[model samples]
Target: MFAVLELGGPNLYDYYVNQEIYSSENKYEIVANIARAAAIALNELHQRAVIHLDIKAENFVIALQENQIDLKVDPFSFKLIDFNTSVLGTDHVKANTASITKIIKAPEIRKKSKNYVNQKVDVWAFGIMIYGLLYSKLNEFNELNVNVMSDKSRYSRLDSELNYYRSNPSNTNLDIIINVFTIKKF
Candidate 1:
């Protein structure tokens, strides 16, 4: 039996690129709501023993309401899609590295090790996605001179960045990202 899925509205990447349509004040909140919804969806899928090998902005669709989108009314309007690369089970699964987005690929995936990947990789990609939404740039972390191969180096760089943001206190949205990282203990 074939199942029909709701196409929903534009994907998160499109919304990100065309964010000018939204007021600057609302953009960050919208992005934050999207991130939260996506995280919940991913967590649900993971709890069901599903591993989405490809998790990125393009895989999340924003559901529009009455030809408009109001995240305040429905924070869960965002839907995670494009599960063609997903697998069943919590064990490490082999994925096609070429199919995954480069910016969000974890260190192991980038290294192309023979060892398979588990849910932790998804968590890493989610973190990268949140970083992109907050900063509007995927290379901000890389620009800090972090050695992508070493997790310790990357975390150290992230710690310094978090410290800078904390000291400045100018960007409130950054606190969200920092809180996420702290909660994840990364």
Candidate 2:
């Protein structure tokens, strides 16, 4: 039944889990990108007052790659996968979870499901995902330019300093959106 597939590498989590070979660059950006996208989607859903109960790596798949990686850790592509645990309409779905993703689970579940859970729950997950991509440089948040926060300390400038806002959250290219083409964009 699960045929008609175009096979690719296993889910990234599986590689990291089983010690299989994978990219060396901190994939924190990848996770952040996924979370960012999810955040945007979740924003729309929340505007309508819906909540997604399940959010995890298994439910995410790398989407595509646009640049040539000089480093082993170069960014690849990914997308959020699996929507099976989703909860929408009604507060009774809280009983269904038994610690699948406590780290990412919305606090509202414990706060009482009647209304504590909202779109911000997904925002929390998005933050975690971005953190995953930024494990080493969480402090870069203080910087004005995310690209200037570049690690090509070894090589390559993070695009042109042309679009200054992308690097600075105050200017917030949040509307700019992250994608496979992000690193490659001039």
Candidate 3:
């Protein structure tokens, strides 16, 4: 089956980093499109009971139609590939998940837990990917960083950032989203 598959254009990380490939579209639009595509793809995979344990920008390929001119149509159709580390069933593993990328790895994978982990791990990684796509920075949200995890720093950053909005309640949404990603599986 793999042999019969058509060749993919380029992985998302490479496409985004290379101005030549993604130069035609607006920056914000491109990011938004990629996020939408990724969410839909992940959702479909989860619905099928598959877990893409190694979800990252590099693992997602940009598919272009045959005989289609670049920028003449949509930028490219996003497709998730490289399932060597993926698990077919939603069962958890007792082994260490250090093999995956450190920045985007889920909390359960980080813990190297002996207990069963489910699909929530994918959701966590998806959130991280969205954050990265927006800010293009991964280190700020990494759990290993003491600066981000520190209550003082966390609140200070959130407070100043949230101050732009009139309603203070929106801050809670940010807190929940951040906390959801920061949470580790024990």
Among these predictions, the greatest lDDT belongs to: 1
Stretch of 10 with least lDDT, candidate 2: 154-163
Q: lDDT per residue, candidate 1, 9-88, as tens digits?
A: 87777776675423466666666666777888789889998878777777888767765654333555566788876767
Q: Give the TM-score of candidate 1.
A: 0.67
The candidate that wins on TM-score is 1
lDDT of 3: 0.60
Clashing pairs in 1: none
Judge candidate 3 at residue 138 and give its lDDT. 41
Pairs that collide in candidate 3 are none
lDDT of 3 by residue, 51-152 (tens): 777677777777778865463326446778877666666766433454655555554455553335567777777766665555554434444334535444
| Local error of candidate 2 at residue 171 (angstroms) | 14
Model 1: which ten-residue window has the lowest total lDDT? 138-147
Better of 2 and 3 by lDDT: 3
* Structural similarity to truth (TM-score) of each candidate: 0.67, 0.43, 0.63
Per-residue error at 5 for model 2, in Å?
4.8
Q: Candidates' lDDT values, in order?
A: 0.67, 0.44, 0.60
Per-residue lDDT, model 2, residue 182, is: 51
lDDT of 2 at 127: 54
